[model samples]
Target chain A: MSIFETIRFALRGLVANKLRSGLTVLGILIGVGAVILLVAVGNGSAKVIEESIESLGTNTLTISSGGFGRQSSTSTSSTSLTVELATALADQSAAPHVKTVSPVVTSSSLAATYEDTDVTVGSFIGTHPDYATASNFSIKSGAMFTTDDVNDHSKVVVLGSTVAEGLFGTVDPLGQQINVSGKLFTVIGVLAEKGSSGLSDPNDLAIAPLSAVQESLTGYGSLSQILVQAVSADDIDTAQAEVTSILNEKLGVTSTSSSTPYRIMNQAELLETRTSNAKTFTTLLGAVAAISLLVGGIGITNIMMVTVTERTREIGIRKALGAPKRTVLNQFLVEATVLSVIGGLLGVAGAVIGSQFTIMGTKPVIVPSSVLLALGVSVGIGLFFGSYPASRAASLRPIEALRYE
Target chain B: MSAHRANRPVLDVRNAKKIYGSGEATVVALAGVSLTVHRGEYVAIMGSSGSGKSTLMNILGCLDIPTTGRYLLDGVDVSKLNDRQLALVRNRRIGFVFQSFNLIPRTTALANVELPMAYAGVRSAERKRRAHAALDLVGLADRADHEPNQLSGGQQQRVAVARALVTAPALVLADEPTGNLDTQSTADVLAVLDSLNQSGRTIVLITHEDDVAMHAKRVIRLVDGKIVSDQRNGHLAASRSAMLRDAYSTAVYR
Candidate 1:
């Protein structure tokens, strides 16, 4: 038979029983929908992690002193880091991978006024201007501080982009001086905006020089930690080992780590671990949804069986009129495929509606592969599920079927 | 003894046997039946229940393969033909109308008639034209769109008859085709069958009622799987009940 003819007959048979076909395809829709959606979420998270890791200087290695534990994110509390160590690292002859080593010390004293808005925030850092380059900061309006400003130990600070907007408003705050506990720091340049990373909001603080902060902001005896960067991103592992070895030899500390208590986390390794976990979770969720697809196939089979029983006499009539078993099987099989294919299309429709728009506007995300895969699988399901029923219809004894009342 | 027999009969059966099961559980459906039917002959096979007349009709219809026999249809031995071949033979040479009007429910009269043509691979346009013609022959062209549920008993039987004759097969094997019909409907359906028979089409009708058997030119009656009465219906009886059907429809329509 021609394709059109097969489709026509199959469509007629499907239309004859609506509820049965509808319920059957519902399973497949849920299965395919779940799989596509979960994979999308997994892909989305992968993108986020990749970007975050790349933002942490893909071509640079960072070394910190004092905050070694995994829980000690950037909170520099230990007194082990000092400006002397930062100077020695910067002066190292063998540290060819070293780009710049800037000691970091933070002090939190609130209450800053610009115009009329006075917000008492926390977490302020004091470091060299090269910290901007190492941390991937992008300036919206002004430049970062010059090295001369760092050398002079001038009481100069730059505001994070968010702080610049939040405090300075439209007025140029570059030339203005902000008072911190009777000490005034000149605003040299406005640091650019760096949006939130996994750890911290880059635009939520003010940055100042380490020497200036020690003299004027914190008044602590020594710096809290040193932020060291390597020149090339690929050499991070080697650079990391060198930094740790130098810290141990310089700090006069004995080797006391079971698994390197001074934890050195490369962003790449963390990203890899996260990606694998996401894949596993996505597949697990997708498998749960696949059960619904299986349910749909079974539904089709059951309904087709019922149809065979109901049309027993018709089968007999056709057989007596010269229809072969193969022809009969083909007819029923065609009908089954038609029902499944329509249901699969409905599933695609359902996924689009269910995922992106109805399921909080995350649309069913038409990955061309999913559409083709779902349709292919459903067609296969129809053949497998419809076989027994179609065969049963074909195998009906003509004599008995004709005798059926 | 017959003109067609001088050549070759359209149907020739010799020592045909059909047993229900094997070994000690076997029940013979047909026991060594032999018969010959020429073309253009109206034959009626009649019997009480379990007399093997029904079995004979099934065999004649090519609905079952005999366990043992030499059954020839149109000079070709049918006992050796495959199931697929038998089905083709049935469609090309034999049309069938059942007692219960085995028209597919929820289908219109036109579609019911066109169904067999579809299985025969007749294209759409020709199928529609021929199906309409069959419906017109049964005087149900106006009711083509109506489903079996909407049609009266006689109309439904007429639709079945239209289906049977739509392909213009060589023979029509109606197994008690009018058994469930009212007298009027039976007359209408039987008259259509009779006219078609008179047009040189072979027809084999199975019936227990003598009133129906009298409509045919020949009768073969079986009792206990054996032929007990084989006679020409030339002087046996007339179909009084079927005649009453024609009278009732004439009164109703005219």
Candidate 2:
């Protein structure tokens, strides 16, 4: 028979066993859905990481004490970074590519209160005035602490937007006093809100003059980490090299080896590492999901085999009616392909709906290419897995089949 | 037994032999059987179970090849053709009516009638027209849209006959076409076959019932892989020719 007639016959056969056909389609539906959802999650995480990197500003770098690389005894001794080193790095002659520098010490779980409204700041940061410009922070209301305030160890603090809202609500907190670890400090300024970025949200922390936090909270002379900003995006590498040498000189280290005393994280490298990691995770998840697709293909084969056996008499009748073996084969194969195509379309719909649900704590991103590819694979699965049963149907002897009852 | 006829026979078999298996398990289904059937002949092959009638019917239908034979079907050496060529021969030259009606389930009567021509690559429009005409010939024109399950036993068999005739094949091979029908349905099917034969269609029906075989113009009885008797029904043959004469006169007057 012609291909069109054969396909019509196959469709009729599938309709006769609706429940079985629907169940078979369900297998492929789930397989494609899993594949699309996992791949989407991978793409979504990569996109989220890229956006976070943009928010961090492309020319900024963070230099923290304790080297990230292999640390031996020689490298370990130079890990002690003091606030004095930060002062020397601020000099233009020592690091010409550096635009600004800020020494920072961060402590977690410091409760601040104004009257009965108590707020636990996620992070309490102590840094100099340059910290505002270096870390992309802006003054929302009151003025920032001055250099004299830093040197005199003034008890003055600047609340991040979220912290300010939590501490004083609509009331002006510029001259109001709040207790930080039982020590009263005057609120001098409120930094503008910076949402979650590649690094933690800057608006969730409270900032103060370096000297005040050093004596009142941490009671340490050593600085936690330093925030550095380059003169321009193109000068970030040069600024990093200049800062490394300056830090080495200030610590009296003559040799620079693989085990540096401090680690420098540039904005560009951070973005690249995170995006590549997300891609790897996506590929791994996609591979696992593909295994279920393979199983789904096997389900098609199993169902096709059963259909061929059940329709032996019908095959015999067709053969007796002068149908060629290839016609019989095409009928069964077309039925399987139809099943897979229907399942694939349903899977695309399911994946789209599934993507809205959070996976790995992030919403999935369904890639168009992945949807098309998954659909193609499902059709291919039908053809590949449907072959044996179709051939078996084609090879049935007319006389035996007619007599099969 | 083969008979020498004035005209070329539609089916001619010489010493046809068919064996089921090899060596110790061998069962010779048809042993040195010979037969000849001319065009427009309504013949019945009758025998009990294990009498090799099915084997003979299978050979005539081109569904199986003989172990050793010279079988010429409409001037072609059917025994020498390959599986695909044999299928083509069946499609173009032979039509089959099964005992179970064997109409594809869930299909309209018209589609079942059109099936053989479809396999023969007949275009859709012509296939539909010819299928409708065949159903009309079998007196099932009104039931063309009905599925086999929705039709009575006699209507289903009539649809089968229409399917067999749609191809205008060289031979109509019916194996127990009315076995599953009631007495009234059997009479209805036999009347359709008789009318088809009267219109010059060639038919070979396989059955063991004497009453069913009595409807045919000739009867061949098989026993132990051999033809035990070949008899012509003088009364039926005479009446068929007289009816043909009457049809010819009516056509002339029209």
Candidate 3:
């Protein structure tokens, strides 16, 4: 018989058993839906991590002194890291893979004011002129603080986009003065909006000359964290190792135990780890969902076998009417394929709809390739598991089947 | 006899033998049985249970192969044909009706009638036309859209007859076609078969009922895997009684 005719007959057979076919379709639907939803959430989180890494600059690394363990208060300790050590690490001769180093000193919950209006600063940071290049920030209007400013301890500051908008209300704040921590500092430049980088919100902080924040607000010798930029993304590991050893030597930490009091984080490695973690989560979820598809395939085989047994006499009738074995086989196989395909289509629709809602603070993003793969796998499950029952139907002897009653 | 009897017989078997089981459980269903049926002849083979009548019908319908025999169907050596080739012969040259009126359930009368044509790879439009005509022949044209369950027993049996005739086979094989029907339904089915035979359609019917066998122009009686009598229906009453007496004596002696 022609394939189209066989398909028509198979459709009729499925229709004849509506509840059974519907249940089978629901099984496959849940399987395919789970795969799509899990993969979408995985890809969504991966994309978010990738964007954060890009914002942080892949070639950058952060060095924090005496903070290897969670219990370490070395960030607040005055003896671990100083401006002089940061200046030494910034030298190309000391760390050849290093491109630039910016020493940071942060004071949180600082209130800034311009005339009568004021905005609460999330963070007030102190750093050198190379801070723009190290952290991928750029001056939008005015210039960054000069080396002379650092040496002279000039009371000049660069406001981030959020800080500038809040203090001056869209007015050019470059020539304005703002009082930070009860001290006045000139706004030399406004930094461009760089969004959050998982470390901090660059758009909500302010930058000042390192000497000024250390002398005026913090009144401490220790640096908060040092931002280091490698010459290229490939040099991040080399730059991180150089920064780690340089800090260990400066802090008088011994190298015999391979234990350094400093922690170095390479943005590239962090990005890779986060992305791989997302992929692992996706694969685990996909595997669990795939088991359902396998079970659905087994369900199909079971139903088809039951169908074959139940219709033994009908099969005998068809065989007696001159149906070839191939025809009988094709009929059942096509029935199974139709079931899976329809279920897959419904699953795709469900996933697409379900992706619009957020689950656990992350919205799913339906990926076209994963959708295609899920559909392909479901169809494959149908064909792979449908073969046994189809062949059983085909191999039935007309004489015995007719006598089966 | 028709002129086709002198030509190639519609079906011919030479010493057909069928055996079931083996060793201590061995049972020979058909032993050295031979027969020839000509074109356009209506014949019935009557036997009690275990008489091998069903085995002979299966062989005649190409549903089973004889263990030791040469059976020619529509002039082809069906005994030597492979399974696939035999299926083709059954599709193209033979049509079958069963005692249960085995029309596929949940299928309309028309689709059931078109089933054999579908297997023969006939086009949809032509198959539909031929199926409708066949249903009309059995006076079921108006009930073409009804499912088997929706039809009465007599109507369902007529639909089965229509399905068998739709393929225009070389011969029709009916195994107790009226076995499950009431008296009126049985009469209705018999009238349909009688008309088809009168229209020169070749039919081979297997039954244990003397009334059913009496409708055929020729009757063959089987006793314990052997045909003890083969004759025209005018002397069926006498021949059936003699055959039964001989079979009873043989059974008692054994």
Q: Of the candidates shown, which would achieve the greatest DockQ relative to the real structure?
A: 3
Off by over 4 Å in 3: A63-101, A107-124, A129-206, A218-225, A229-264, B1-6, B234-254
| Superposition TM-score, candidate 1 onto the true structure | 0.81
lDDT by residue for model 1 over A1-405, one digit each (tens)? 455665676677667777876766676666556556655554555556566667766655444444345224534333356777677777657566778877778776456666566545355678888777776765555566667777788888778776777777888988888776557877777866653556666577777877777787687566655666777777767776777777666665467642232334565566668667756855675676567677878887888898888788877877776677887888789888877887787777766665554333222334567667777878898899999999998988788887776
Which candidate ranks first by lDDT, i.e. highest?
Answer: 2
Cα error, candidate 2, residue B179 (Å): 1.3
Computed on C-alpha atoms, the DockQ of candidate 2 is 0.67
Clash total of candidate 2: 0
Residue A184, candidate 3: Cα error in Å is: 6.2
Clashing residue pairs, backbone N/CA/C < 3 A, model 1? A59-A233, A139-A192, A321-B91, A322-B87, A356-A361, A356-A362, A356-A363, A356-A364
Which is the winner by lDDT between candidate 1 and candidate 3?
3
What does candidate 3's lDDT look like per residue over A1-405, in tens digits?
Answer: 888999999999999999999998998898888889888988877777787777779999887765445225344443456778888888888799999888899998799999988999998988888888777788899989898999899999998899999999868898899998789999999988885656566689898988899899998767888888898988888888888788767777676744566678788888889889888987887788778778888888888888889888889889998999989999999988999999898989999999999965677888898899889988998888888988999999999888897
The best candidate by TM-score is 2
Candidate 3 residue-wise lDDT, B123-203, digit = tens? 999999999989998999999999999999989999999999877776899999999999999999999998876665678
The digit string of per-residue lDDT tens for model 2 on A166-255 reads 989999999999998899999999998874764566688888998899899998856778888899888999999899889888765568
